[model samples]
Target: MSKYLFKSRLTPDGMKGLLSEGAKARREAVGRMVEDLGGRVEAMYWAFGDEDVYVTAELPGNTSAAAMGMVVSSVGGVRTTTVVLLSADEIDEAVRQEVHYRPPGG
Candidate 1:
């Protein structure tokens, strides 16, 4: 499984729906959504910013992550951005991979 950070901005309809739902109800709904994606929501928060909600979760893979993001965004009630989170070991492994590249004007 891989970790991810999900940032979401509520659409007008989403905002209205949130206003009508209680905090517990929202949490339950989010939990169910993550379960449906075969993932677990580790943390979630409602924030005051360009993005309304932030979520941390562990999903099966990139495909699962993309699928979840697509489904949520298609609802027209929220726009989401999913970023894959890597651990220190993963970063170290990535750093070992070689790629042909050059700096600008090098």
Candidate 2:
């Protein structure tokens, strides 16, 4: 499994739903959705800024994450951006790889 970080902003309808259902209900609903995708929500938070919510989840892979984003966005409730999270060991492995590439106009 891989971890992901999601930043989201709620639409007007989503805000209405959140206000009616409450934050706890929203969290549980999100958890169920993640579980259905063979993942688990590690943490979720509501914030006051450019993004309304932040979620850290462990999922099977990028496909599951993209599916979640598409479903959520298509529902007209929330817009989400997903960031793949890498562990320290993963980063170490990545740094050890040799790449054959050059910068543009280099």
Candidate 3:
């Protein structure tokens, strides 16, 4: 499984739904939706900033993450950007890899 971080902004309709449904219900709905996609929500937060919500979830892979993003975005009530989260070990592994490369201006 892999971790993903999602930052989202809700449209007016979505905000109205959230206010009506309450945060807990919405969180549960989100959890169920992710579970359907073979993922689980680690944490979901409602914030006061440019982004309305932040979500941390663990999914099978990029496919599941892409599906999640697509489904949410298709609703027309929310916009989200998802970033894949890698562990320190993954970064270390990446650092050990070597590839032939050329500088952009070289």
Query: How close is each model in CA RMSD to the real structure?
Result: 1.4, 0.8, 0.8
* Per-prediction TM-score to the true structure, in the order listed: 0.90, 0.96, 0.96
TM for candidate 3 is 0.96
- Residue 26 lDDT, candidate 2, scale 0-100: 96
> Where is model 3 poorest over a 10-residue stretch in terms of lDDT?
68-77
Comparing 1 and 2 by lDDT, which wins?
Answer: 2
lDDT of 1 at 68: 86
lDDT of 2 by residue, 47-103 (tens): 999999999999999999999999998999899999999999999999999999999
- How well is each residue in 20-103 modelled by candidate 3, as lDDT tens digits? 999999899999988988889999999999999999999999999998899898998799999999999999999999978999
Tens digits of per-residue lDDT, candidate 1, 1-106, equal: 8999999999999988888996568778888988887889999999998899999999889998999899989999899999999999999999999989999999
- The most accurate candidate by lDDT is 2
Model 3 clashes, total count: 0
Residue 104 miss distance in model 3 (angstroms):
2.1
Clashes of each: 0, 0, 0
